[model samples]
Target chain A: MSSITSAKANVLVVGSGGVGTMAAFALEKGGKASVTAVLRSNFAAVQQSGFDIKSLDHGDIQAWRPSAIRNSVPNTATDATAQPYDFIVVTTKNIADIAPSVAEIIAPAVSPGHTAIALVQNGLNIERPLIAAFPSNPIISGVSFIGATEEKPGTIRHDDHDVLLVGAFANPNIAPQASAAAAKIFSDMYGSCPGIDVIYEPDVRFTRWRKLLYNASFNSVATILRMDTSRMRISEHVIDDLIRPVMLEIRATAAAAGVELPMELVDRMITVDTFEAFFKPSMCQDIEKGNYIEFENIVGEPLREAERLGVHTPALKVIYGLLKGLQWQRMEAKGLVKIPLVSEPGMKYGSKPRVVT
Target chain B: MSSITSAKANVLVVGSGGVGTMAAFALEKGGKASVTAVLRSNFAAVQQSGFDIKSLDHGDIQAWRPSAIRNSVPNTATDATAQPYDFIVVTTKNIADIAPSVAEIIAPAVSPGHTAIALVQNGLNIERPLIAAFPSNPIISGVSFIGATEEKPGTIRHDDHDVLLVGAFANPNIAPQASAAAAKIFSDMYGSCPGIDVIYEPDVRFTRWRKLLYNASFNSVATILRMDTSRMRISEHVIDDLIRPVMLEIRATAAAAGVELPMELVDRMITVDTFEAFFKPSMCQDIEKGNYIEFENIVGEPLREAERLGVHTPALKVIYGLLKGLQWQRMEAKGLVKIPLVSEPGMKYGSKPRVVT
Candidate 1:
């Protein structure tokens, strides 16, 4: 067992969305490190009013003090905070595009040995880019189950119980330390947490592809078709004609990549016990909000990968084209607005990038 | 040439939607005889303010003195000058369920040749039941392009210039006297009317199937997916994934049914020429008005037909299921009222039975 060293960690929470706020609350509640939450103007308001957590177990956690800065990626650790971040949590959509020039700002503090980063966003390949950017430090990839929403800056509503899964992208050996630290930090936030899961699965590549297969079939299908999972299950017109083959193609692609995905991955999609039917899917939400979509990351990249792997993704290709066409059509229809359809191209927001994990 | 022997034919335009109003205007503008339009409510107001007709070519032809009645269907065509109808144009959805009841109400003047019934609605397989019920005379299958809206019973807005295409479901020749008479009446309706296109195309089945293909792709795809046609055309997501496969499957089904559709049907969809981004699709309009959809007639039947003909329609089947799921999910999420996920278990809409051609 690694000895418990008396170390002070510096943490920064970016992109004050539901996940971002939850990470901040968890970090400050851990009481092991100093945490600063950076947010955009939209979320900065929530932080200003104070972070509020309406936990299922705790009822509500309120008035948590944390620094909320606007969307600016700082140049140096010392500038955004007194030190560099021991860990930075980014929990936003397609941050690479929206804040390409906005990564420098953070809660200024650093003790590199005590530092690690966790990314808590949906989609397959969110970690490699960050890992590539920060080579020496521990950059953790996290998958979250808890559903949360930030009512305002600093104010967040925890509506459901969600567990966090953490893993190192390239190193299997680091999983134990990362998991221990992550578990301790998260448990202190609210006792009786479901506990954290850390896996050093032989191939992270497969895991990524597996998750992406689900997204490609469920998310893009739902988004492009503008229906929920349950809808796909029930409507004969859609089920037999639209969804099954796409799922089949995705399954084939996974097999081609030598990933023995648990059959349940596809099975569970149809037979899931509970589903949020009307809940606008993440992609649907993007379309509705007219934000720049992470088309390449979520769809294009995977498809290109499939091609390289010599797999036929005919169905996926069709869906991808439809989405791009619709995205373009929407942009053209919007006429003069500088909207991001495929990538968040040249979005000029008035605030800084929010730091979220 | 068939002699125009049906002099001053008495025509009743039943139902208050766009089709009903346009049918009446076509009859009146032709000045071939007496015409009466029966609207449920909106037309009542339009009539009170004096009927407004805005022709596509004639511009705004306001305050035309034509016969108008305000009330629901099944009402008498008996207002002194308005005896039963030489031709009763029943323009209502769920016609199988509604037609039998409507027929009882209008039986007061059901004559043989002088009173041929015409149906102007969307979808395939619906006409058979109506034809089965009223088999005494020719039940001309008419597809209209005259886009009109009776904002009130008294007002008709000629939004777009379109002609009615009339044909028998399976008959190559029946000596279409009524169809010829119908054309003469429509020719006088303002200017630029294509007159009535009475096609006894060698493959009548193909004609109907072709139309079904368009509706299947356009209305259901655009509506359930919440996109307009123009956007659907150019969307890469739509082009590759959604549209192409669906179109191919639809064509396959059409071919299975002996319908020879030109490849241009799809090419036309992609390169709609100057018409590219300016068209308003019905599905988009349906979404805007918050109306329950006619998913079955538009998409459901063709898929079913494709299966009967031993064709593989994977795309259509999936789309079918997704639509049902979305329908139920949307209902479940919207209000306390639950409409059910299963659509009455096998489309009980057109239950009136089929008339042999």
Candidate 2:
């Protein structure tokens, strides 16, 4: 671990999509941190032409580049050449992949005691695995209220809200001093960045649950219905019958898990006018692009937790089943999984007796 | 009412689509009944060319005509010219419509004590309103295990099994002798007909409950998923998690309503080799055509009954909500209902402060 405490910190941003790119830009704009972004598919284009962000808050930023861009995760041997990162920011959708998990991917770059890992993904109970994997490294959980989309490989359009909530992962085993210091350092760096508001929360679970009120309600609904937020709002049946019931169930589930999310959060989530009218949530966008939905991280994990706590979440379970069906279809379309012939009902009964008296 | 029993019985079949046409054909082939069919949009074609049925069992019936064909419902004044129908067969999908209901449509032709109303539509409690409207007329409930589709306006494709179960509606106020005679007479006519088997069921409610085992489980799920039965069968998750639970709830609801649906029925519905593998249920077919779903008749009526009977049907309720959402969307598409702009999340915020610290 690095003993020298430098004024200028090193930050490595992994999975630089819409959210990751924004974080990379913010970190660079903050000037306190030098940022390096790991790109997967568009590494060459982004490296040569830089990242382009057409944002509502920041306006148009053409060809914005970070300090360095690498295509893949750096191994421990390659990591020995550079200074250990003070903060490793992960902004990938928490969908399971063929590659290693986020914790394993960032392991080589994360400094043991000094570097804090900030998870900026949407969903609940995301920090547990990271904490389990790296007990010494401080884990920072974040909930972002940003309406952004990657229009192309190297271009992003930030359409609406740009507020982020960052907090130290509340682990009783970890020293409070270490977690607080790590959270404070990361929060201060993003707070100073232009075109975004960053709130340092003492309890990250609160923010996670709060953001879940919107994500859990709208994401799968939008994807399943193939409707935008505006269309969903316009249908009273969708809002009152489907969305509100789901949010209520989520609140009850959260409470059962000892989170005690306020009923006002559910009320605000249904009533509050925070999002852009035609804005599609990230999961909906994933469906549009035929990408795998983050079912486990977003809906499955929370549902499993609810089941464990003996909370009744009928609405949530229904939504989960639907989303999983779509996910199964997506996997089949992508040839990730074999499409079974079992669903075909026509082939089921093979020319049986035509007449039965 | 006519006390004389004629050598040839007068029969009127309303809404002769797939199931109705087949029934009309059976009655005509029996030679003891003179059949009249009320055609909707295809009145001219059917009157000119006769009704065409391409059947897997009976093979292609190129042009089989009923004794008479009329487009609109004959008023009581027009009905005065002919003998009142001994059997008024209503075979349309039992979806509640904007126009007058099936009971109201067939009111003019009913001969009270002499005329019997046979409901061959798919659903539960369909005999209720008919019984209320035709107090003196015996109501015969029919459950069809026929796999057929109206390929066009005047054409039907009978794909698989063709078994019809007929039973008297067991109303406490009605004379059991009259209902039994009506049911037996109709069953005898269809039983002697070519290419189909007809069975006389003493308890109609039992048959209704039995059919609900398959319809309640597969119909709405297939519609919501926009998938055929074969594809639905392929997903073990969908069958185990969704279809079975819904059937179980339906059984419970039936039991609460003084009807015991066997667990064996539920098991058979899921595993039975009766259905063609690729066959889409009637509800799913309705969804594909953008026609109004039979939510009230199939899912809503049963769900409301369960609620009234203090029976828990969480799975059915979820399916009801989803089907309602889809129905709402269909209504919006058809301009039958005013499209409200309430669901827009972007408009909800109304230019609120972008940043929240």
Candidate 3:
């Protein structure tokens, strides 16, 4: 164990948002890993001045840089001298439709039989693409519950909670016992620090569904309604009529997917997790900032699973539709896609009036 | 029949919106009724200059007014010598939570046993209040489909369609045969003009549900999404996933209420009625203008019926909850209702950090 702790593993964190930065901070502070973060938009500023983090757990952290920083991932063909990464942790928003998918983004550093791909992300059925892309690699899946936001580039404001459930996704190419061993190694290194709470989950799918009970209902509903947690909870009959029904639909869908989330989880999410006044969910914040939402990974993929399992989810269907509409509107505004105008009828009415009242 | 046509009925039209003004215009144009219009906000402008009417059916008219105009509805106690109206046509917006209810607005002109109350409104179970108030009076309920808008104080723009389904509500106090006769009399007078296609529906509850199949689904969905008909329809999977599911819920609810609206009506409403480009539904318009929406009559009352009948309507319930949230937001913005701010927890986290990474 001391020899294992003595040799620091190289971990690469892709998509350095609030979650990514915090994970990097925790991993490096653990002293069990040498962390390199790829900062796309804030590469220059962060390299120049480092991060200024005001966190509930870490208190005030000023002008702190990770062990290493890279603007772009190294291409193996172009740079033959690039070192192999022990783990490539992805912390980006799980939007499946964007160009150069997350799997492709982390392809170069993903060393087969060596690099364990750890996904620190939100959503359901998110491990499929990575698993499909790198069949030989063991995928470390995580469901993180953290209150962290990048107020600006290299500026983070994290709230109190920071809990994560980690497990190995079942991979056809890799042995099941080997995958579990890989996940244990990754989680041990990740939780080596004082601030991060990482629990090893044998069945991460169950854990994923457990987290989705709150996310699929409150997050989506609050975003669509344009209300904060406080406002949504305080609104009359909103919980009983809308949010609770959505949660029940999710619970049913989870059951169909071979997971039984307790009905009590719904009550805990509504009453305990949403106890914060005016706390905006990430999706709500994304919408207000005119950023692209993760409808496909969070709601769409799960809805497809529900459909495959023959579960009826009318509430989820409507929520999915509305989110799609909103995201399309945003895309159109950003000139990402041009929606054609509907063909107008030549005349609004018949040639002659039926009656002249 | 000739005597009935020749007799000039005394008609008082309350709530002089586009629907009310057009009803008044049509009744007077028929040469069978002396129309007295009660105009609230536009009373001064309309009384001073009359209406500048540009209609698709009626063509253009410079200045037009009903036979008589009054600023306010007469109060029986205050105006003891007020004339008793033969029929009071209520065409106002059916907002149930307002101070002066639609039933009370025309209470003074409602002559028991003699005057018939014609509700040219859009909603379900709207006749209940009036039925409760004037038990002996005939309740002439109408489901109107007209494209008319009051652009300004004294300007009107009328589209081509002008169809109405007229029927009488079943009143316990009045004989059924007498109620039918009263509905016939009112319909004849109202549709006397050449442009109005008035269909007498013996089962008006069926018609109300039929109309609600569109209003409760498309209208409410469009408003919540902040998208017009074109935008909503053109979005991918919206009609199939969101709008159609809502219509199915309404259809099931209608079936539970003993009204078998055909499955084909959903197709008709989606394809034909929504053919027009950028057509904003009335509820969407009401939300844009910050007016109180008719959620209670259009979606709320029907949802209540579904609940009472033990029919599950998850889609409708969600739509109802959202509309309620939006309206409450609007009300709070207008300082109508003060929503108390939630008590903030003193501290966000526990005493000590579990881990500080």
Candidate 4:
């Protein structure tokens, strides 16, 4: 057995879905880290079969296994072999579920002085919860431009884009150099992997808002309409009337939050080459499968931020209401919440109740 | 041979679906009018079996047949027996279908000086087309507050209420007495029918705007979400966020059109009885069945009018865009329209196009 070495990094990836698995592969490919992934469901199959990534950039990866795979966060009190990881990568869809919070999911593997948390998820205002939960640990915010889906169990079909933008959280309490150093380490690890390009951003908030320019518009609209980006991008009316307006609202909201997203970003979002590649956004996929959407983190938080900033975002407000209503409807259908009754009384014609028995 | 008498009024009901059949039955029930109906697709079934109205107020009418039922308007030039009718009731859904316009549908049966047009539809700005078509004919605008559905062919399930508000169009060219006389005659004929109450309003524009308060809000929201009024009315958040804002925009638009719809009407629309009766608006039903919606008359006209009048209606604009996008998407799916390609070129990463074959 090899002794523990300070040069090699130990990484723990939580929520081994498509993005999680991709991160794991990228980390292991760097050859400087031992990666472990924690999966919720399909743990047995993934542990036994490993991962299959059919990438448009890289050739098909038949069965790429990580150093270790576990179903849940190892109980540090029970497992003697478990050790604190230097980096914890999170990649779950930010929906409200019975699973543990991001903080709780990484608690067992985090060491205060050494561990850094990387969030590879969609939407805005997501870093707040992590920041609130862990004040001292370095936080890295990652926005992925890859299109991936896990239609088949234990396999990921990655589309043409596999780019990631990562930046350290601008926390006044934490040293900037320390956070930047941690982010660079992650970027180097992820960038060394084939077919993956990781860029270091100085301002993660700006990057997040830039990514939200697409997510806030295309993701929600596609999910709501049950259509793909190809279908949506085909209509000039949709781009001009629906998508552009939503992007403008997000831009305005970001401006209120002290970030000025360039207008060219909107143009780039609508005119992107891969827009007609028949990519169904992850939110749309979740909705198609009757699964819960990451509505709160993606739409709700941004809308709330807009409201708090006293900026009127009519398009975002409308989208949020629609998505919230749909989420509530799903919950009601599943007996998770009680359907509220109509508050008004029955009709009365000429002072007599119009009742039919 | 029957004697030609002015005492026997001649009426033609076009598009004999649920609303059209109900009007035919009510007109025939008055015993003062000889009613003829124009059936479109179900001409054979309706002409052979007649209509079946299952009502909560009046007992079920097993088979109610009009005096004459024809598949199309009779060729007045060829058939000497055909006579111009005194009234033509237009009840087909006001969608932008590939079929003939409403004016053209009733043209073969309309007499320029004598036949008054009754529009029993759910929308705003519908009378403009009729006015443009017939410059001198008296136009009667009617709003029906009845719940009816055609669950089976040739049958209408009428709910507890069957109330109609009718008035002469506020046309400057037409004499008020002439339009009022025709409207009064139609109202008396309809009111005489048991279980149906018809009210004659002098201010027809006010009535229309009042009815639109409910239609523009509940109808559009229901169609956009593919949800019924019962489900929508249950959530106060939906009302506060979506429904009420839409109504307020409609109210503002009406104000810009020199009509002030009272806020109390907005309250009544939300709090009215029978709102929670699982009543799916006609637009919602149209969407579920993959049929075209009355977007122009219901949403587009109002939005355009608001723009013309220089009033801001942001919520309505967003909703209109979404509905229009969905409409175009449906058309594309049905091969009615071509899907446009993405206009931008592929991405270039560091002086090389990122191409994957």
Candidate 5:
């Protein structure tokens, strides 16, 4: 990966959505290399226009010119505007949500020994498809701890701290180097932004699974009930009655995944009593905007994963069924034009939803 | 009461809010009584023209005439511009949410032996203060099961099978009689006006608790997640992990109140979920309209009841805390001249929230 480090590096940050934009802006601000931000829509306007960069101490809707691209033409392979990149950061909001579109697009850009690619999204098994596609370039499976949203297209409004966990997909030796390189870039970029903490996680998959505990707890409860994160957090009924059992099931699955998380981590999830008091989750936001939620992937995929690993996920099964039904009904309402409604009610999954009653 | 009932009751359905106007129109069509439909401020225009009643079934916007109470004198004794009421249905939305002084405007009109005040709104408890004010007036507490929303300030867009649960303040004799009276009147009203199925609830308090289960299970979840009812009901995780436990907790508290619900009540709640695929709940509507919710009463009171009865409610508690915090934050943002641009991490309420840690 000398091309990305040794020579003058041209980084292309594709899918300039919420997370993508955050990463692109961070990389651009790093000033280590030139980063070209590519988006799918009229996002350049949002980028060019001053948007609020909110952090713990200082938050202002500032403007920055970060060499933006909105799905237009590539200048040329040899030209500065259209030249091939030394490194590519593929950050698509639910790009994997609709199959292998991101992999399909980014696979062409990977220059083998020249560039390295990183995925900053949720769920496990993200690296498999990309690694499968390239097999040559070092692919990093990363987990971003920051919460981000865009008011306009390019203007990313950062809410939470910017922390990251990165690890090599196949090659474990390159992970430390990858993590250090990425950290150096991000630290410079987001130094002014409050709480930018990064942890070089060697066991990226296990770390991803550990984080699943958080998502499974919040996502299932929040989605089914259509609540924001804070609401789910502050609720006693949610914490003790609802989240505990669901979390316990998640823990079981995590254990089955061969990942071991500390009890302290589990406890932290349990005691989050003040969340619903503020902040709306992405899933809830999606529902509010009448956009599609990643119910199947968020709950369904994990349960399937657990089942494959011989894990017990009774509570998750129930939640999965309910969420699936909710989504299916929407499809049915459009004159059965979309998806099937009421496949099953949760208890267990993959074997069909067996009605408890 | 007997005189008005015998001589075709003259009812003043005051407060022409969402529930009020619908009741006014319904009572007028019931044909069992003459209704003087009154709006708080817009009564003048309604008096000049008429009221619009929109129905989903016929896709028709029907008009109706009422002896308007705009700039009219208020004298229950005098039958000139006003008349003695048999039943005065107070359909103010979330009146319980407001301060006692604000919500207590109708205390003077609700005289015992002259008027019967029925609260046709969401939430379980209603008649405590009303009963204290007029013990002899048969302070009937009817929880309306109809799914209708006021399209305009004075217009009711009747959307569902017009169903209502009519009962009274837990008293054996007073409860069923009021329910029966209202039921018969509602049945005869406008040839059941697109099917007004008013059930004669023996104990409306029980019915309130019962209907509350649906609200807590569906409304709380749907509002927080910003999804329709079907979306919520479909997810297995939502159903098992989130909803069922909440329902069970609610059931425990209801049982503690010496109430025994049918085994299939939860199933029934899910069955009725088909109609609400795109259904935006009243709570979400209220939030969107920049109005405070009946959080303390609808969600909070139920939680309190559960606590008092020693029932465990984790999901509900989490949801409650989340909504409460959100409402508070929104309020703070609105009231504060210069608001904080930064926000807490969406992951703050992760499955296992950081607070619990």
Candidate 6:
């Protein structure tokens, strides 16, 4: 390794969606970190010509490239020259029921006891898998409040909030000091970037639950009803009948799980002025594009938690069921599911089977 | 009135959709009733060409008009020669929130105690409105299990099932004998048709709840997910997760309300072979066509009943909430509800006014 490489921390981002791309940009701006971003569908386009980003927080940036761009995550076992990443910052969607999970995708670059794995994604209970995979490694849980979308391949438009909450998960297997140090180091570097606020929160579980109040309610409703924020908030009874009840249910679930979220947050969340009238939530946008929504993470996981806690969450459960059917529609379209409209002989069923019935 | 009209029972079928037209056809076919149909949007089309029906039970028919057709229900106050009908068979959708309720639409034709009001429609507690309107009149509750759809204006495709459960809703204000006699007369005339089987069910509430086990589950899920029956039953988990849970909720609600629906009926309803792979339920069709769904009657009323009976129905409640939001989309599109994307100065909101916020 070079002298400069020894001085600077190495950071690798596993997903190159709008969030991951922006996270890479912010980490690169810190200058104390060498950033490598793994891109998939937009790899060729970005490699030929980097991201064209128009941001409300950070001014327009044309063709900005990270220190290194990769088509796939680097494997230390497969590649002789692969560097041990200090912080493997993953920003992919926390969608369940996918073929190679996030843990499998980012396993290669992990340097055992050295590299601290940081998850910059939405949803609850997302940190457990990484903690299970790398018991010795520090797991930094991140919650980003950013409004960003890759309008097209390598074309990003970030027009709203850019705050992030990062916390080191206190795994009993690892030293608390080690986890805290790792989180602080990563948070310090990320926080150094302009137009971004990265808070080093010791516990982020409550924060994740706090954010879910809106995500679980508004995002799911918008997708199910096929409306944007403006149209979603169109009627008082829609709020009184549909949205508010869901938010209340989510709050009760959180409270049942020992997190006492305030009632005023519901009002603040419902009236959150960050988004414009036409702004669609990421989940809603994912559904509109016929992509598999992050149903399990955003809605299903919370409902599971509520179930575990013995909380009555009818609103949440119903939304979860509806989303499950909706996500099936996408899976069916992608030929990932076998719809048994007619019976087939010796056909497998469930997630793998080609015949549904 | 003609001599034949005096000899034969005079029946008026309001709202000439598939059900209404079919009811008129069946009544007229019995040769004991002279059927007059009130046509709405398809009045001109039906008046000119009549209904071209392709039925599985009865042979295909073309240009089959009723004995008489009118644009509107005859108002006795305005029309000097209006006949006091024996049975006013109302077959329109049982949607709650509308400008003119079914009672209002059929009020002018009701000859008070002389006319027996027959609701040849779907849903629970539909007889109450008619009972309230004409306290002394006999209210006949009719439930039909038929596969029929108006493909266009007046062209109907009736493929399977021609069974009607006719029962007298015993209102305390009306004599029991009067209610029973009225029900028997209507059932006899309708059942005399070669392909139809009409049973005089003394109490139809239990039958309605049994029917709701299908409508509340499959029809609601189908509309919310925008899938046909075949695709909806494509997966076992989908049935387990969505359809069955809703059926269970409906059953629990029914049982709580003192009507025990059989559990085997859930399986029968789920695997009902009457529908083709492409067959969409009426509610699904209504949603696809942007018409107001029968949310209040089909799903909402049951949920309300469940709430009143103190039955915990998370699945039903969530589906109800989702449908509420979905129905709002239709209401908003039709300019029934004002969407307040932006705050307007002193604008009236809710069902009326143009400002949403």
Give the top-scoring candidate (TM-score).
6
Give a tens-digit lDDT track for model 4, residues B29-135.
87778888888777777777877889776669877789998888875546677777788888888875445678877777776677788999877778888888887
Task: Name the runs in model 6 displaced over 4 angstroms.
Answer: A1-5, A273-278, A343-357, B1-5, B273-278, B344-357
Give every prediction's interface RMSD. 14.4, 5.2, 7.2, 7.2, 10.3, 7.7
**iRMSD value for model 5:** 10.3
Q: Which stretches of candidate 3 lie over 4 Å from their true place?
A: A1-6, A274-276, A344-357, B1-7, B97-100, B274-276, B308-312, B344-357
Candidate 2 chain B weakest lDDT stretch, 10 residues: B348-357
Question: What DockQ, between 0 and 1, does each candidate earn?
Answer: 0.17, 0.28, 0.34, 0.39, 0.09, 0.33
lDDT of 4 by residue, A1-357 (tens): 012235768888987877788788878887778988887775877877877889787778887789999888875545788776778888888774434567777777766666788988887767677777777778888888777767577888876567999888865557898888888888888888877878998889988887788888988888788877766666667777788898998899999999999887777676553554667777888888888889777778888899999988888898888888788777777788665444444422111234321
Q: Which stretches of candidate 2 lie over 4 Å from their true place?
A: A1-7, A79-83, A96-100, A104-114, A171-173, A229-234, A274-279, A340-357, B1-6, B79-83, B97-100, B107-114, B273-276, B341-357
Rank by DockQ, descending?
4, 3, 6, 2, 1, 5
> What TM-score goes with each of the models?
0.73, 0.90, 0.90, 0.92, 0.61, 0.92
Candidate 6 chain B worst ten-residue window by lDDT: B348-357
CAPRI grade, predicted model 4: acceptable
CA deviation > 4 Å runs, candidate 4: A1-5, A96-100, A273-275, A340-357, B1-5, B96-99, B273-276, B340-357
Model 6, B69-169: lDDT tens per residue? 99999986678767778889998898877768889999999887688889878787788887888888889889888777788999988876688999888
Worst 10 residues of 3 chain A by lDDT: A348-357
lDDT top scorer: 6
Q: A1-357 in candidate 2: lDDT tens per residue?
A: 123257767888998888888888888888888888999887888988998899887889999999888887665346665677778899988875334677878887766676788988888777888888787788888788777777788999887657888888875557877787778888889978877888888888767876777888888787777766655666656777778888888888888877888776665666455344566777888888888888677778788889999998887887888788788777768777664444343533323333322
